[model samples]
Target: MRTPLFLLLAASAALAQTPRPGVNYDEAKVGSDPLPDLKLTTAEEWTQKRRPEILKLFEDNVYGKTPAGIGAPKFEVTATKTDALGGLATRKFIHISLPDRPAWPGMDVMLYTPNNVKAAPCFVGLSFGGNHAVSTEPDVPLSTRWMRESKEKNIVEHHATEATRGTESSRWPLEMILKRGFAVATAYYGDIEPDHADGWKEGLRAAVSKEGANTVWKDGEWGAIGAWAWGLSRIADYLQTDPQVDGRHLAVIGHSRLGKTSLWAGAQDERFGIVISNDSGEGGAALMRRDFGETTAIITKAFPHWFTPTYKSFAGNAAACPVDAHMLIALAAPRPIYIASAGEDHWADQKGEFLSGKFASPVYALFGKKGVGVEEQPAIDTPVGDFVGYHNRTGKHDVTDYDWTQYLNFAARHWAK
Candidate 1:
């Protein structure tokens, strides 16, 4: 006898809520070994003594080791317009070329800096769509790179067209950011590595392989996330060279997968003074051990190229992983980092993300800085923290005006001196 349709639906909903052992949810159990002692007298001592071990653990088990010299990319300015955004902003397009791979299409960077500010504190991030999608400005060049097409978004034949322009504008409020005296820099993530499993064949990984046989990453080496994070650092390298940008005040920000890239970039590169992750759940700001939503197994299976093969070892056994998201956040010691979530985005595990920030507080204390001040997750839209900040806004898993407001406020507190 088959079950009734209504009964099947009801059972599915019930199962979703029920926390299955070692699956959707895990017992909140911390390891017996304590976190690297944040009680050390000086932040310098803590950095010198404990930071390396934590960094190594994450590289070994999660994000994988980023090869050195990934930063040394040549930059070329392709175009510039002083009268963009109705004369309120200056738009510049840059081309980033990797060594020994001049034939590769390379990455394109779009920068919008307010004309009023001589040296603006900029927000640098990787975008899911092409740079053209960030704004409606006619000057922003269209990306010719391979894109994950969406007919609804007007991206036809795996290529970006004019109709896709400004589609992602909600995620990147350029005019608002410019009016607030901040600059925004963005690059298409696919230019670094396409999102598909075989994307490595056309990206930096392939470029590295062409340099020498030994440079090629073995299986389980750095994956798409690492390449995207490395791409952000290359953007940072260009930002440091520009006179319009205050390199010391650079902040790296991202949403969803790019948010994961932002955290990893901030952790590896100290040049980013402020790091912000919006709905960067699961492999991002959320603790892996929580298993509340978007479990390790789920992510690995969905995107096999996002992490190393070593990460598979702990897919169903997150408790055995030597490092957790909290440790990844802690790696940004003393830097002002903000982790935002959405009340409706349980798949990103809002609660798990908040707890990671809370657990990372002790490391901030070592630098005489504060962390998320509250013990419990605050009410929706209530932003909290000192050096480490978080807010689960009343929305879904997308960046919005409210999220940007909190980030601007947080940046003002730290960057506005």
Candidate 2:
């Protein structure tokens, strides 16, 4: 039977009005409440009082509070190669472990510093692939840890293989970074913990828990993201001791989930002079209040292990959540941060990421710093802002050389000045 034209049109309208999973794109539906004001007048007030309060809100409700008394990480320089990368850079491998918590499998960090520069500024980040995947060098050990299975990424049977080597080299760009006089320090995310629901059982979280593998996570306990961030700080700890690297000028950077990790790490550790987020939509740079692509509900359900159980409560009711991504950006304050989004990556909500920086501008103003200066989101490919940098790159979800160019320029501006 043929349907009438008007009835068909009416049905189409009804279907359009219905919301689908991961398709929350309406701007009108975004949460309208004003972001929690940085009500204090002085920088001291913001720093001494409100900053800590906001930090705790994220820790307690979102990422979970990092348990204290884990004690200092013990660092061992496993390898040093001054003639690495054909003598263009010096490479060192540092194995970091907790003395008291020997059950926890610690991470191995890879460092590359430009041989031409002494105490070169460094970029510290976590990689989805192991260090062997970042460089083509055969000597870089293949990570034997549990990895998520992906045939395309060459991670087979939850393990990294020969095919995985240099799979992610395009993202690292160690030569380009070294030529620009910046050091790169990175570790595999799985080294700290495998990225899965039961990752905690074999990760640092379990090692610290009194019950070991039998530990049941509490509502506000730290999750995978917290553990990864803690690992970044440990890299910072080792970088500070390396004469070839400028630890004081370190930048903590990550992409996707790791981008969220970098933001949380930068917020807690003031040593990261710059924080960069690439396509870290939703729980990373995007404001949760905006029911855009990837909502709190979507992320929480898909990867509940990434955040505190408390965060799951605000799944559909994001406005009720005590903190927003703007507050997370605000925590960076006077320090320079670069938030990047991809043009085709709607799943991460490009506009929501831009608005995060815009809303965070007032907090930056408190410290006499500027943020994304425009009133509206800039056109695609147009980068904006000062102390708080942002750009919607002309690509898909992954990071690329275009993104690296902006980062190198942004870091040079602040680091050189």
User: Taking the tens digit of each residue's C-alpha lDDT, what string does model 2 give over 289-372?
Assistant: 877877898779767889999999998887788888999998998899999998877778889899999998988888888899
Segments in model 2 whose C-alpha atoms lie over 4 Å from true places: 1-22
lDDT of 1 at 1: 88
Worst 10 residues of 2 by lDDT: 8-17
Evaluated with TM-score, which candidate comes out highest?
Answer: 2
Whole-model alpha-carbon lDDT for candidate 2: 0.89
TM-score of each: 0.90, 0.94
Let me know the TM-score candidate 2 reaches against the reference structure.
0.94
User: What is the C-alpha local distance difference test score of each model?
Assistant: 0.82, 0.89
Superposed model 1: Cα runs more than 4 Å off: 1-42, 210-220
Please name the candidate that would achieve the greatest lDDT relative to the true structure: 2
Q: What residue pairs are clashing in model 1?
A: 24-291
